[model samples]
Target: MKNVKWFAVDIDGTITLNGNGMVNLNALSKLRYLARLGYQVVFVTGRSSIEALALAIFGGTTQITIGENGGVISTAPNSHKILADIDKCRKGYEILRCELTHVNEKSVFPRMSEVVVDRTFNLDEGNRVFKEKGQDLILVDSNYAYHINETKINKGFGLDSLMKALDIGYDEIVSIGDSTTDIPMFNRTKYSITFESSTKEVRNTATRVVKGENGDGLINAIDWIMEQKSYCEII
Candidate 1:
């Protein structure tokens, strides 16, 4: 947490448990405290831009959010910047939809820039088909869902946009996530934290791995960071 001014976090599976929905109250309390300590706490998530806005408003964030697996920026409530062209995304979906299994629009969450479906589908084949079509769309899997976004759109890109908007540098941000999509953000920041339940690759790539899982893990990471900085006022 040294030199850190912002905490970019993934929502589902990072700050929220399997049944906690958005996040547990305890985790949200800790996040609110962190924001009160004058740090920008951002939610870089695979959830929709509207959900990101709700989380941001609740956490008192610096109005910077990365949603849709880095394909969308919720710059303000009810307003969003979509990284992928809507027409291209629709076309790609039309092609990729046929390759999926046990999934459809109903199984997917509403999103601004990309389509998010359950992991029960055939992800590998979907990617292959999209590539064969020469579409710029790419499929990214997070902790619990798969996001189809533009080729260059990812957590890192969304974070870069947020940082630029805030006039913040990479070194001042701490990126925490629990999925492969987070690897890009890990590459963009100095402080990277992953949950214990994260994939082996993510844990190995992250700078630190907290002991607990999900929301509890996030709290643990925050406690460790605060300890490193020797600041206990949040308690």
Candidate 2:
């Protein structure tokens, strides 16, 4: 019942958005209020810093974010750190061949490492190849399957690193996420809440599931935690 001192949040579906790049102002206000209430908020997302940083601006300078499935953490611009550098995921010949050969009728297989940085996209060339293979290729700032690319990085590893850095116990924290990728956090956190909009697997593992979708669910969770503070506190 203590005030949720640590909040590990997801970005895409939880905060930033689904199809739009814009954010919900009410959510931002809620987050700011939580901070003033003494919660340490951290963004545990699969996005790369390039994409996630834009979203973090909504939290102002004090916000902390985990990107590239926890391969990167930036407490501030100059404070960027790689929590887990799973470079083995870096594109290689054998991996590319395997990825291409395993491609399904509805899936795009991209040699993401061979990706060409372009004006309009992060990995245009990679997406092109995936498309040529008759797969549905979408360029997300994150690869939830990054472990497929390299066994090193993933949402779980990132969450572990964030907890170590903050010197907070998992038992005192509440984590909220909405993806298969978020499973790692769900598995480890003391309390896990899945948004009503999450995938089936994510919901199945949740300790609690909120009613609203997207940031609305997150805001509800935060309010619930703050309400608990009237009974408990963690020092």
Candidate 3:
């Protein structure tokens, strides 16, 4: 890979083969292979940083993880950098809970900087409520659940923070994902890959949309990149 030294990947729909959160071992293996090739693989996800860290540890990738969709970053086992105000997210959640009775909290790993709720209510209605109440919070659908995050934070912000911390440039990374939440990351990177299962907006945001879905799609993406003479000059 030319100047690319890092692979930033989303976990849920991007690597998980099934909707029930079953990981695709094949994709995990492919990530491991990339790691062996000196490409640091970082998990940038909406899932809890702890959970993503665990995946990184067990999957034999880099231990760094960006969690809560740009609100939190885990650099070590017991250390995390909080990027967003969880209090504001909590406040937004409370407002939504009070206004939308059907908006129930989803049972998820403990979050450090965001609130996650089940995808049972209309997101536009929630956005309208936030707009009317002047809350600086936004709801994002991760395809696995709904996340209430700071209006100013996103995966791109998180990745930028990580890049700065690691002394990596923006152009030194490649991003992969399957949802609109990953669009910010896509915009920040020169090479972004999404799958056919992603919505048109997400596909349009990516530099390329690969065939297949989930882990199979991830492998296909790696293969496609390997075939690109511009990106695979040294490899």
- CA lDDT of each prediction against the hidden true structure: 0.80, 0.61, 0.90
Per-model TM-score on C-alpha atoms: 0.90, 0.72, 0.95
lDDT winner between 2 and 3, please give it: 3
Residue pairs of candidate 1 with colliding backbone atoms: none
Q: Scored by Cα lDDT, where does model 1 land?
A: 0.80
Return the top candidate by lDDT. 3
**What is the per-residue lDDT of model 3 for residues 79-177, given as tens digits with 9 covering 90 to 100?**
999999889999999999998969989999999999999999999999999999999989998878889999988999999888888888877888999
List the lowest-lDDT window of 10 residues for candidate 1.
Answer: 100-109
Q: Write the per-residue lDDT of candidate 1 for residues 1-235, one digit (tens) a residue.
A: 4678789988888778773565766777888888888988888877776787787786666676788878888868767878776567677777766655565653654777887666777788888988888988887777467777888888899888878877888779888888888999898888899988888999999999988775888889898888977763443
* Candidate 2 clashes between residue pairs 3 or more apart in a chain or in different chains: 2-232, 89-149, 89-150
**Which runs in model 1 stand beyond 4 Å of their true positions?**
19-22, 98-103, 107-109, 231-235
Off by over 4 Å in 2: 84-87, 97-149, 231-235
> Global CA lDDT of candidate 3, please?
0.90
- lDDT tens digits by residue: candidate 2, 1-235: 4635777777767765562545666776787777776677777766555456555575652367776666677776556776432333333323344554442211222222212121232344444554565442233333323222233456777778777877768787788887777777877788888777777888999888887765787788777766567646543
